[model samples]
Target: MGTIKDDASLVEQALLQDEESKRYTGDGSVDFKGRPVLKQNTGTWKACPFILGSECCERLAGYGIGINLVSYLTNKLHEGNVSAARTVSTWTGTYFITPLIGAVLADAYWGRYWTIAGFSIIYFIGMCILTLSASIPALRPVECLGSICPPATPTQYVVFFLGLYLIALGTGGIKACASPFGADQFDDTDSEERIKKGSFFNWFFFFVNTGALVSFTFIVWIQDNAGWGLGFGIPTLFMGLSIGCFFLGTPLYRFQKPGESPITRLCQVVIASVRKRDLVVPEDSSLLYETPNKSFVLEGSRKLEHSEELR
Candidate 1:
């Protein structure tokens, strides 16, 4: 009986120690360092292939569209040099500026997944419209009517410009958000995974360039010989496939709610400071009585106090 009681106490003590150790284990809880490590094994690495695949496909489609866009606008669209230049400028400006908008939208409203998916649909629609405009001569009359009025005759060039603008809007959204979205997938808290995340950007760019190289070399030739419809159509097909591929890994992708950007936070701080400056203060306050003075021993402290009083 004595031996059995001693053994029971030993068992209880062991159980208590086990529970305490688990509670204190650095890996088991939600500390900043531990959270990331815990998430590392939660299927993030498996999702990387899909992200990389989407990146490659996006680059391919973009390059395919780019390599032939000038020629398509000038020659196939049948525009004068002046008209083509203006159209190109408009298209380029829209393409560049819309990305900033897309980034803001992605961060503030849409998560990366939704942003990519939504923009991809828009991209597909834009590609379809471009292909349709290039293929069907009859649709050109309606589409180009605005560009071709009494002052300016409707031209295939006008249709091309409209199509290019739509494509720009779509591509801008994707370009701005996709990479950052992909990076978001890796759990950065784990040291090994953090290293992998760092490596992902490099690999992402490499694959994108590879896709671009292929598209520029081959897709351009197909467009040059096969006709505009087929040229644009190929990219449209690839974009669709890319979208499908992205969706395939949706379950594996980790999402982060967009937060205020550093610039935005800085701007907010500045605005708040300005507003505070404009605030009315009670006349009798001790801060209102503070004065600036120069003294070597306490000059810095005095200056800070004076500044705070002014604020």
Candidate 2:
């Protein structure tokens, strides 16, 4: 009997140690299958290299196209300096602005992973079209001598601009979600992981600049020395690789579930505030309507404690 009791206590202690050593994250992030993740098995530095690779390759492709686009417009498309500048500026604006649409989709409906994946496809298609437009003789204006160059036909213009705008739309989606998605890999509740999250952003920026550096120097050299086809094609390949890296990391990713529309929440808050405008303030902030649960009230959002300063 004494031996049995000793063995039972030893087993209980081992179980207790296991439980203490392994704690799940308080944040509502789950694995790809919508199951709770073990900190030891998934996320953190393990998943970062893939995310960084995706971002790096994407920036390489994006910046590669954007940097020399003005020259492509003037020399290849036969536009004047002002026209080329204006066109590039317009496209850049579109690229930056498209993120708003991506943000809404990621936050309210699709979440980050799917948003990035979906947009990457669009981006890849655009790159392919752009490469083809440069490579195929029929898609581009004829090469000319001196200052006299043949103007692009309507069809040529349509093809080139179609590719360009598709790239803009796709990049918007990628830019909106990539950073947040990377950040999601780190558990916010864990102090060590939180520190790593901050480090991830630092390295993220570093890799972004690294991509741009390669784009500016190496890709521009290729565009100038080699033909436009190869220049565009190489970046297209990089874009494909970016997509590959992202998908490969999918198994390890921690997906933050999409939440209720923030816009709807804001509208509700406004309506409620206006309706209660005449009510007296409660001295006890505990009377305010906040969820009792310590965990997330919704997948992506936590209930904030009521504050007097905000009122």
Candidate 3:
């Protein structure tokens, strides 16, 4: 492969390759490594379906959990009417905040794959807790360990809250990084592959929504009819499947090493600009211009005038 300089060179290389393959009719003047290039079979689009399937599964998992979450907290957990609102709010906040933590951890400590896997384990534990809470209602009296116990209190609410927080954290990590990670699979230097990458995001989201719709309609309905355990369990199952699917594509997936952010680069530029002696003015009355003409002078002119005054 030839070294790529810019977009124009990439496009030209693509067109030249196409011409050599007889996929396009043109004079084959372009040479690769001093030899007349012949057309090579680029192969069929195999990975597109896998990408779409993964996205669909992800959306389904998200939608299923989201649509049923509030009802699960209030109804299944049997949180009192007043406390239900606060409980739901807490759940929502944790879900949103975990992503920021996940992103930071992913960039600084865990690579994307490992971060996703670790969080997924935490998510599964949360699901198990939710299931246990729903199953064992009598455990509610043990709140805070050694606190006064109210007889016959339900523990479902406590379990549900803990579970929801875990799921939120896992979702935050996966949502922040997966798309960009997936996009890294395509080689952008190749024009044909680059065009395919542009279309990848569109299909990625489409499958996600499809999964969500299925999860919402089916998972919620199952929970309503069968039991809370089955309802929460359904999402757990799908999430597990989604994780497996992600790993299946691991061989084909491209991994990009994390690097410093643009903000860091910008701050460096600003610090360097500020540190130059010529860029900073001294805090002295003697250096101040005393005349009206000096007030309207440009920076270079002021410097020249100050030098002249010194002479």
Task: Give the best candidate by lDDT.
Answer: 2
How large is the C-alpha RMSD of every model relative to the true structure? 11.7, 3.8, 14.6
lDDT of 2 by residue, 1-311 (tens): 99999999999999998786456666778898998888887889889899999999999999989999999998899999999999999999999999998988999999999999999999999999999999999999999778679999999999999999999999978999999999999987778898999999999999999999999999999999998999999999999999999999888888889998778888999999999999998997676756567775666865554567957
For all candidates in order, the CA lDDT equals 0.69, 0.91, 0.59
lDDT per residue (tens digit) for residues 1-118 in model 3? 3455577798999999876666421222112122332223111134345445655665676666667666655554444556767766776777778888777666555555567667
How many residue pairs clash in all the candidates, one count each? 2, 0, 5
Cα lDDT of candidate 1 equals 0.69
Worst 10 residues of 1 by lDDT: 295-304
TM-scores of the candidates in the order shown? 0.70, 0.88, 0.64
Write candidate 1's Cα lDDT for 105-223 as tens digits.
77667656677888878877877777787788654433345456222236554555566677788876788887877776554434565577778888889989988998988889989
Candidate 3: C-alpha lDDT: 0.59
Candidate 2, residue 141: Cα displacement in angstroms equals: 0.2
Query: Order the candidates by lDDT, highest first — what do you get?
Result: 2, 1, 3
The TM-score of candidate 3 is 0.64
Model 1 / residue 191 / CA error / Å:
1.3
